[model samples]
Target: MEVLALLCIVSVAFTGLTRGAGLLPDGPLNAAVGEEVMFTTTLAPTEIPFISVAWTFGDKPIITSNVENLTEPEYEGRITFFTSTGYLQLRNLSFNDSGEYRVTIVPRGEQQKTGTTRLDIYAPVSNVVVASNTTDLAEFNSTVRLSCSSSGSSLSVLWLNGSSEVTESDRVQLTDGNFTLTILNVSRFDQGPFRCHVFNPVSNGTSDPVNLSISLSVSNVVVASNTTDLAEFNSTVRLSCSSSGSSLSVLWLNGSSEVTESDRVQLTDGNFTLTILNVSRFDQGPFRCHVFNPVSNGTSDPVNLSISYGPENINLTKSPSQEYFEEGTDISLICSAVSRPAALFYWFLNGDKLSDTGSELRLMNIQISHSGNYSCQAFNPRTLRDETSQPSVVSVLERISGSSVTPSTNLPIEGKSVNLSCEAAGSGSRMWMKDGSYLILADNIALYDNNRVLSFRPLTKTDSGEYSCNISNPVSSDGASYNMVVNYGPENVQIAGPSEIRVGETLTLTCSAESTPSARYNWTLDGAEIHNSSVFTKDNTGLSDSSNYTCHAMNNITGRTSSAVHELSVTAIPAQTSGCSAGCIAGIVVACVVVCAAAAAAGGGYYIYTRKKRAKSTGDEGQDNTAYSGSQELNYADLMSFQSKDGVTVQLGSQNNSSKDARDRVDNSRPATSSPPTYDVHMQRMRSAAQPDANGAQIYAQIRNS
Candidate 1:
C-alpha cells in the first residue's frame, strides 16, 4: 500500500505542477462591448517544445496554435494568437462574450500548462428613460412614483435632482436597483426637476429632467385698516385685505353688504385695498374681506370704522346796532355758534385780528377814525373748524359849528373868476376882510348870497393874499382865514441879445418873464423849439445859422406860456488883409493900373480916329460953305450951319489950319447974351454927331477937364 500511495502522490503532484501554469491580465481585464479582450499563458522555461496551445471563451475553444494559429468558426476573423508567448486576443467582444476565458499550453517534456482569465464585456447604458406616475404634485395630498429604464447590461440606476444624488428618506422609497423612487405626500418642498442616471462599468448616462409642480388653494384671509385708530370726516382712509395662497380672489363687504366702487370709494392694488376718499359720517361702518380660490374660500373678521365731526351753525350779532352814532358812544359785538364741542371766539377789525379772545367786542369810546368795518370769527380748535361773520360798518359823526371859508379853487388862474363862501353853523351876519383889513367891494369884486360869498370877476396878483370871513351867531362869534394863491402865466416875456452877429463870434441871449411862479424857458430857432434853458449861447455864429429865434417862457404849474421873437442876422467875416503877401498885393495894384491905362488908351485912339475922319468929311462941306460965305463975309455961326436931309442943322468949327485972327475974331464976335449951350444941348450935339470921331476930340477934352 505504501508503494501505491507514493505513486498516487506523485501523480497528484504532477497534476498540481501542471495546473500551476496560469493566466495573468494587465489589470482586471474589463472591456466595453465591441472592444478587444486578451488572454495569455506562460510556461516555465524548458527545452521541450509545446505540442499545442489553445484558448477558449467560456467553455468554447476560440483559438488553438502549435507552429501556427487556428481559430474556431465562432471567432475566426476576430481572434489572434502570439505563437512565441502563447497570448490570445479576441476582437469585437459582445455582452454574451463576457465570462471566463481559458488558455492551455502543452510542452514537449513538462506537464501541460493552462491559464484562465475573467473578461467582463459591458454595453454602456443606452436608451435611458425616467417616467413618473403623475406630473401634477399636490401639497400634502399626493404621492408620486418614478421609474428609470435602460437597455444595457450590469446597469446601476440613480435618482438625481440636478447634479446632486437623491437622498433616501422616510417619504422616499428606492427599489429595483434604485431605478424607481416613490415619494409619499408630495409637498411644495418636494416639487423640483428630477433625473435618473444609469451607469455600468464602462460608462454612465442620464435621462432628461422630469419636473414636478405643486398646486395650492386659499387658506386664510386678513383685513385691516391702514390707520386703525380713527377716521375723520372729509379725510381719506384705506383698508387692505390679504390671503395666504396664490391665485386668490378678494372682495370687501360692509356689514354683510357688498361694497361697490364709486367716485368716493375705490378698489386698488389688484383688489387688495379699499379706499374711501373724503370720508364722511355716512362712510363709517363695519368692514370685512372675503377671499376665494378654485378649491377653498376664506373670510376675515369685521373691522369697525368711526368718524368724528364738530362745530356748526356759527353767527355774530351787534348790541344796539345803528348806522351812525355820536362821539363818546359805546358799542358791543357778540359772536355765537352751535357745535358739538364749544367753539372759541376771535374778533377781527378790517380783517385784522385783535388781542381780545372773548365772544363780546366792546368799543368804549368811538371816534371818527374808528369808522370802519368790524367782523368776528368762531372756531373749534379740536376739529380745526372755523366760520366768519359778515362785516358791519359803524360811523361816528361830529357837529358842524366852526366857521370856515371855502374857496371854489385853491389855485385860481390869473384873470379867472373865483368865488369864496363864508359858512357858519347857525344863522349869523357875515363879513369879509383882505389881509386882516376890512374888505371893500369894487366893480371886479362883488358880494352875493347875503354877503356870504365874495366873488372876484378877474383874479390878479394882488388877489393872492390871506382873506378872512367873520360871522356872528346867537351863541358864538367866529372867523376863518384862507391863504389864497393866484397862479399867473409867464408874462412880460423879453429876450435880450444882439440882433446882428458876426461869424466866428460868440453870442448869448437871455430870456426873462414875470409870473407868480418862476417859468421854464424853451428857445426855438425859426418854428422849431431848440433849447430848454433861460439862456441860449452860440459859440461860433455861422452865416447859414441866421434865423428867427424865439424864447417861450412857460409856467408849468399854470400851463400858461408867453413868447418873444428876435431876428438874428449873421454877417460873414471880413477878408484878412494882413494874411496877403506883398507880391499878391502888387499883382492886384498892377491889374488895376493896367485896366485904367487900357481905358485911357482906347479913348485917345478913338478920339484921333474920329477927328481925322470928321476933318476929311467936313473938308468938302467947308469948301462949299466958304465959297458961299466969301460973297457976303457971312458970320462964322451962320456959315457953319448946313441943312441936312432930315432938317437938322450942322455947325462946322474952324479947322486947325484956320488963321488965329479968324479964330480970335470968331470967339470975340460971339454974342455974350447967348448963354453957352445948356449941358443937355451940348450932350445932344455930341450924341447927334453922325461920326463919333467928329466930336471925339472935344468930348474927350471936356470929359477930362470936368
Candidate 2:
C-alpha cells in the first residue's frame, strides 16, 4: 500500500510534464588557471501555440513560465540564452565551470525538461627550464642547491644533470604548490636545463631554460716567521698554509723544485705547514707557496732567506812547565778556539799553516825535529775574518832509569791495606803517581806527606796503575805498576702489592730485585721467601705474584752472581677469622717481623748475631751497609795527626788494628817518623832603592839610596 501511494505522488508531480528544447555544449574549452570561460544551455518551446517557456536548472525555477533566459557567475556578461531554438552560449570557462548544465521549459501551465551537457576548462600547454650555480667546467663534488619556477600552477619539476635527467627523489623537493622545484647534492655532471611542466585535464605549461656556473678556487694561505737573512749553519726558519672554498690542498715549493723529506724540513696537514726546525748556510734559497684546486691553480710569490757568518777567537798553550829540559825529551802543544760565526781551525809551523785538511797538528815520538815555534789560527767565512794566537816554543827531555814501583805481596779481602815503593837508580828521594790526568806526589801511601817512604793502606781499585819517583834534584825518574780491586752493592728496584691484604682471599704477592749493581732478590708474599707466608696469611697457598724473588744478591764491583734464588709463598685465613680487614693487615706486619727475626737467628749463630743478619734478610739492611761504606771509604782522614794518633778515623768499618801493628808491618830499614817530614825554605834578598828626579815623575834614570 505504501509503494502505491509513493508512485501516485511521483505521477501527480510529472502529470503536466512535456518534452522541451534546451541548449548545451558539445566540446571542452581551454584557459589559464585564473582566467574564466563560459558554458551555456538554453530552454525552448515545442509543439505549443500562444505559450511561453520558463528556464530552470536542476529542479529550481530560473525564469517564469512565459519567459526564457539564463546566466551564471562563470559566464556573466559572456553567456546568453535564446527561446526560439532554445540555445545558450557561455562566454568564459573556468576550472570551477567544469560541471553539468540543465534547462527546463513550461507551456500552458505544463512543465518540460530537455538540456544536459558537460564542460571542461583548461590552460594552454607550455615548457619550463631549470639551472644551477655553474654549467661548463663545473666544480667537482660540490654542494649545489638548484631551483625552478613557472608562470602556471599544478606543475611538476624535472632536472638534467649533464646528460642525465634527475628523477624526482628525496634529495629534490617541490614547494610553492608544485610551481617551484629545488635540488640538492649537485655534482660536476649536474649542469643543465631543468624542466618545470604545469598541466591539468585540459592543457600543459613549461618555462625557459637556465644555465649554472660553479667555481672551484683555493683560499686561506699564510706563511710562518717573517722572511729575513741569517748566518749560515747558525739559524732556523719555518713556513705554513691552509685551504678554504675548496678541498684541493696547497703544497710548499722551494723555487721550481719540490722539497723532499729531510731531518731539517717537515710538512703536515695536507701539505699545508712547511716547518724548518733548523737552518744551514746551504739551505738558503727562494721558497714558494702553491695551491692546487680541482678547478683552478693558485701560487704565491717566491720568498728568499739569505745566510752569513764567521769565526772569532783563537788561543795556543803548552802542557808541563815551560822551563828547561834535556834534549830529545817529549813535549805537548794544545790549540783552542771560540768563534762568533763559527770558524775552521788551522795549525801553523814556523808561520806556515798546515794544509793537511785536518784540525789537529801532532808531532809523533819526540825528536830534534819537534823543537820549534808553533801557532794556530781560526777563520770564519760569514764574517770574512781570521784570528791568530801568540807562538809557542817546545823542548825535549832525556830518559832516566830506576826501580820505580814495589809490588804489594798481600791483598786485602775487604779492599784495604796496600803498599807501594820506588828505588831510584839516581837516588831520588820522593815518588808520585798520575791520578786521572793530574800528577799526585806522595811520601808514603799510608800517610801522604812531602818526605817519606810511600806505602798505601785501605786501597781502592783507583789506587792501581803506574808510579814515578825522583831521588835527588836533577836525578832521572823511575816508574812501576800496581793493581787494586773492590766490591759493591745493589740498586734500582721496585715494590708492588696491596697496601693491606684480606684473609683467605688468596692471591697476594710481593716481589723485589736488584738492578744496576746487578742483584737478585728473595720474595716474601705475606712474610718470607723459602718459608711459609701462611704464618700471617689465612691461606697456606701462595699467589702467582708471590715468591722469594731475589735480584740475586749482586755486587757490581765484584761482578759475582748470587748462588741461590729466594722464593716465598703463603696461605691466608678467611677474613672472618683474621678479623679479615684490619686484623689481616696487622697479622701481615707481625708475620714479617717474625720471619725477619727467624732469618736473622738462622743466618748467623746467635752468639755472633749482628746487623749483617738484617742486611742478609731485609733489603733495607743493604742500604745501611751502603751508608757505612760511603763513610768508611777512606783509610786516612787526617794525614797530619801524628800527635793525636786516634784522630784519623777509618769509617768503612770498626778500626781495631793499632798504629803499632801498622808500624810493625812496615820495613824496619825505612825511617818510621811518627812526625811526617816537611820541606820549609826561607831566604832573604837585599836590593838598592831608586830616588826620583826633580820632575818627581818617578824617573827611570839610574839613582841609588843608602
Candidate 3:
C-alpha cells in the first residue's frame, strides 16, 4: 500500500502547493564510502490530514512509510524511514549509490508536497605505492623518476622525504595529477627514505618508504713524506698517501713492485704508510701509492728517495817536497778525500786549527815563525763526519847568504882604535876584505879570532873603506859588506871681522874652522878671554875696546886647538863746546867788579850818614858815632880781606854797639845775593888747577874785593 501511494504521488503532479511542507538534509548529503546519510521532511500547519512519506534514489524508491516503513530490494538493508517525522536514513553508502534523493508527503484535504536533495558518495584511498626509476644513485650524475599510485578517484598525490613535503625546484618536477615526482641531477643532499601520500575528501594513505643512496667516487690522491726524503745511512723515514672517498683500500709500490710489510719496512693508517727503518743504499728509489673504491680508483705520483754517506780516506799532499824553503818563499798544500759528497777541507798547523776552509792552503812570504808540522782534515757537511791526514815535517834552513859584517863603533877618532867584526851562520869559514880585495895587514893593523876581527891601533884616513866578510860552507857560499869611517880634527882655522872701526859703530866678528866634526870657538881681547862663541858682536865701539882680538877653534872630538888674531882700531870722538869764549867771561868778571865797587861805596856813605843821624837824635852820640863808625871801618876791612883771600863777598851790619864785636866773631858768615855768579867758581877752580900761572884765582879775588 505504501509503494502504491508513492507511485500514485509520483504520477500525480502537486500543483498550486500552498506553503505546507518541505524537505532538508540534517547535514551535507555528500558522503564517503561506508558512511551513513540522513534526509528529513517537515510539515506546516493546515486543515489537512497526513497520508504517507516516501524516499527515492534517482527516480527509484528507497523507502516508504504510512504507518510502517518499507524498503526497495536494492536498498533493503541499507535504508530506513521514521513514521512520526518522515525522516530517511541510508547506511554504508558507496559511490554507485550517489544520486538525487527525494521525500514526498500526501495530505487528505490539502495539496500534496514533494521535496528533493542531492547525494554524493566517495571511496577512501588505500593501497598506495611510490616507486623510483632507479634505486642506486650516483651523486650529481643521475636522475630519478618517482610515481605515486592509489585505488581511489579524485585523489591528490604528494612526495615526502621523512615527513617533510618535497618542494618543487629546478631539480624536482611534478606530473599526472600530482601522482609523479621527477628529481633531475640528484646529489647526495637528495638522499632520503622518501614516501608518497595520497589523499581524498574522505580518507588518506601513505606508500611504503623508498630509501635512496648516493654513490661517491674516489678522487684527488696525494702522497707526502713526514720528513725530507734525503736520509742518511742507518736512519729511518716515513711516507703517507691520502684520498677523498669512503671504503678506501690503499696500496704502496716501489718501482712498479708491490711492497710488503717486513721487519724493517712497515705499513700503517690502513696500508697508506711506507716506513723504512735503518735506511740503506738499497732503499733509495722511486715509490708510489694507490687508493681505490667500488666506484673509482686513483694513483698517487711517485716519491723519490735520497740517501747520503760519509767522508773517508783523507789524503794531504804538498807541492814542493824539498827539505827546506827560503824564509820569503811561497808554498802550497792540497788536501783530498774519498767521499759520497764532495768534502770540505780544514788546515791545521802544529795541531792547531788555522780557521781556514778550502781544498788548498797557500803561504806567502813565509817567515821563520811559520815553520811547523802541517796537516788537514776532510769533512762531510751533510753527514757530520770527518777524517784527518798524517802530519808533514817542514824545515826552514839558515843559508850562508845571511852572513853579515858589523863595525864596533859608528864614528872613530883620528887617534883612537876601532874593530870590525864578521859574522856567519852554520859553522862556515870566514875571511875579511877591504875595498873588494883581500886585506893585507899593515904596521898598525892586526887580525884575531880566525880573521873575523880586524883591529886598527889608530884610525887614520887610510882606515876608512868598505870592509867585506866572506863565508864559505859545504852547502852554500855568500858574503856581506860594511863601510867604515874615521873622524879627524879642526883644520884651516880662520877669523873674520872689520880691521878698522869708529866710536859708536857696531862691530861683528865671526870665527870658524874646517874639521870633520864641528869645532867650538873662544874669543879674546888684549890676551884676555871675552867670548866663547863662533860669532861676536860689539855695538857702540869705544877707544877702550881697541885691542888685538884673537879667536881659538878647538875640536871636541880630537881635543886639538888652533887660533887667529885680528887688530881692531877704534878712533876717538872730540868734545863739543858752546859759543862763549874765555874773553867774554873776562869781560863779565870786569862788569861784576865795577858794580860791586859802586855798591860798596854807596853802602859806606849811607852807613856814615845813618850813624850821624842816630847820634844827633839821641844827643851825646857825636863822639860815640866816631867810635862806632871807626869800628865799622875796621869790620869792612876784615870782610874785604877775607873776601880777597877766598874769592867771595861779605856784608856787615850792627844792631847795637856790640854788633861790631859779633861781626868780628863770625868770620865765615855772609849775606846771599839773588843774582847768579858772573863766572862759575868751580870752573875757575878747575882752570886754576889746570893752569897754575893763568891768574884765575887772582882775578876772582880782585872781583870780590871790588
Candidate 4:
C-alpha cells in the first residue's frame, strides 16, 4: 500500500505540473545514476476498450502497438510502456537519455488523446577531494590555499572546518562558489583541518579531512608494542610510537582519554614509549601515539592491546529445584563463571573429573548411583586458572516396587510363632494392616526390624484374616495382601440324630467339628463302619441298624482326631392282637437271613454287603439265638449297596436275626474284596465276584471284615 500510494502521489504531482500544456511531467523526477525512473499518467479507464497505443521520445517512436522495430535502439531493453494506464518505466538512466516523452492513446469511438512529458538527467556527485597547495606551513608565518574538486553536473561545494562552515572572512576567503578556500595571515587558530562537501540534484559526497600545521610534517606515526601477550596484573608492557619528523614532541592516549605517567605508568624514550610495570586489564587499550610540534600533530591509527583474564566467581545451579528425584528421571546442572574469553567448564562428581565438557551437565534416567555431591570447575584456558563451585548435593532415590507381606508360614498353626515381614526392592517405610484396618498391636502382636516385620507370637484362630503390607516413599507406594489361615484342631466334635425311629423311617445323623481344615467324618454303627461322610443317612432302618454310631473328626495338620458316639434304634410295630375268641395265639419270632455275597461283572455288576464282622455277632450269639427261639439267628453284616459308573445305585436288603439286649452288640468294619476277581472293575475298592447257580439264581457267600 505504501508503494502504491507513493506512485499515486507522484502521478498527481506530475498531472498538476502539466495541466496547462496538456502534457505529462516525467521528471524533474530526480533519480540516481544507474537507477530507474517511472512516468505515471492519471488516465481514466478507457470507456471504449481502446487498442491503438503509441509512445515516443521527442520525434522518434519508442514503442507502439502492432509496430516492429519502432522502439529507439538505445531504449530497446531499458524502457517499458503500459498502454492501458499510460505508465512508463525507464531503466539504466544516463545523461544522454534526457528528452521529451509522448504517449497517444486512441479509444474506441473516441479521438486520440496525447500526453507529453519532459525528462532531464543529472549525474551523481562523487569522488570529492580537498587538497592544500603546500602542507608544510608555519602556523604563524605561512598562508595556505585549500581547493575542493568533484565529478558531477550542476554541483555546489561547501568547505567545513571540522563541523562549522568556513564562510567568507578577512582571514578566510572562498572563491569559485566556495570551491576555493584561502586562509591568510595564518596563525595557530588558522591551521585548519578541513573538508570539502560536494552535492548535486542526484547525490552528495564528502572528502577526507586535510590538516595544515607548522614546523615539520609528521608522517607514518605508528604505535608499536613490546609484546601482545600480557596477563592482567602479571606482566609489564610498553607502547612506543615512531614517526619521521624533526623537533617533534610526543603525546599518548588510551581510547579518547590521554595517558599520563604515574607510579605504574612510565614514559621512556623521550615520551615516545608509554610503559606500565603492572599491565592490568584496564591498561590494555586502543592506544594511540601523537607527534606534534606547536602547530602540527599526527596521531597513529588505534592499536588495541589484548590481555588475558581469569575464570573467577564460579557458580553452579541445579534443577528441578535440587530435590529428591526418583529413578528413571532426569536432571540438569549448569555451571557459570565471570571471565574473559569465556571460561571452559568441567563437571566433577565427588572430586572426580567427568566426561562432560560444556557448561551444562544433564543426567538422564538417573539412578541411585547418580546421586552424589556435584561440583563444577571452570578453567580459563588462556590464564591457566581454574575455580570450583561449591558442591551441590543431588539425591536420586529408588522407587518403591515389589512391596509384599510374606509370612514365615503362609498357614501358621494355632498357638505358634509367626512373623509377617513387609519387603520391597527400594528403600521405604513399611506399614501393616489387618483385614482392611490398621492393626492394633497386642501382647501377642509386636513389630521388629524397624517395623518391617510383624511378629504374631502364639497365633490364635482370631489371627486368621486378610493382612496387607504397604511400603511407601516420596516417589511411589505399593502394597500386597496375604490371606492368612491358622491351622486348628477338630475340637467340640458332636453328632446329632434321633435315638429311636420307625423301621421304615430315615435316620439322619449329621456330624460336625470345629477345625481350620474340615475334619474327615466316619460313622459307625455298633462298632462297625456305617458311613464315611459328615452326614450319615440310613433309610428303611431295621432292628439290626441299632447300636452306637460314632463320628470321628481329624485335622491333618494338627494330627489330632476326636470322636463322639450316638446310639440309635429302630423298632417294628407289633402285629394287631385280633385273637378274641381265637385262643392260643403263638408269638412267633421268625428270622430269615439274607446273606450279602460279593459279586462283580465285566460291565460293573452291583453288590450290596455290610462290613459287619462275625466276631461281634459271636459274642452275642447266645442272646440272639435265645431271643428268637425255635429259629436260627445269624448276626452277620453285609454290604447293602454299590453305585455303578452310570449312576445306577443298587440297594440290597438283609434280614438279620436281632435281639433287644445290651450284650447283643455287633461290630462292622470296612468292606473286603470278593473272592473271585473281575477283569473290568468300576469300584474304587471292589470285591470278588460270586457266580450264580445252575437255575440262574445267585449263590449266597459271607464276606468277613478283616
Identify the candidate with maximal lDDT.
4
For candidate 1, the C-alpha RMSD (Å) to the true structure equals 31.8
User: What's model 3's lDDT at 41?
Assistant: 58
For residues 255-333, write the lDDT of model 3, one tens digit per residue: 8888888898999878988898866545665787888764567899888777776566678777786646766777888
Please provide TM-scores, in order, for all candidate models, with all chains considered together: 0.29, 0.24, 0.30, 0.31
Whole-model lDDT, candidate 3?
A: 0.70
In model 1, state the lDDT of residue 602.
46
Q: Write the per-residue lDDT of candidate 4 for residues 1-706, one digit (tens) a residue.
A: 6577557545654565563234355345676668888877666443334566787877888777633325667777998876556677899988767877777766554466677766778788888999888876765567889989999888998888889888888888889888999987676565567899998877899999998765655678998888877887679988889997656899898888888889999998899888988676667788999898744679998887777767767888988874688988888999998888798899889999999889999999998899899999987777777789999998788878887788898669888899988888988778888989998888899999988989989898898999898888777889998899989978899888799886546789999999989888887766788788999987767778778888989888878889998878787644222221211111100001222122343143333222222222223322322322332222322234444345565443323433321112222342332222122221212222222232212112211110
Q: How do all the candidates rank in terms of TM-score, highest first?
A: 4, 3, 1, 2
Residue 558 in candidate 4 has what lDDT?
Answer: 75
Clashing pairs in 3: none
What tens-digit string does per-residue lDDT give for candidate 1 at 143-239? Answer: 9999999988888887887677897898989987798899998877676689998888887898999987665767668887876445345578899
**Whole-model Cα lDDT per candidate?**
0.70, 0.47, 0.70, 0.71
User: Which regions of candidate 3 deviate over 4 angstroms?
Assistant: 1-22, 26-28, 40-51, 105-114, 161-164, 221-241, 245-706
Model 3 earns a TM-score of 0.30
Q: What is the C-alpha RMSD of each candidate to the true structure, in Å?
A: 31.8, 41.1, 41.0, 25.5
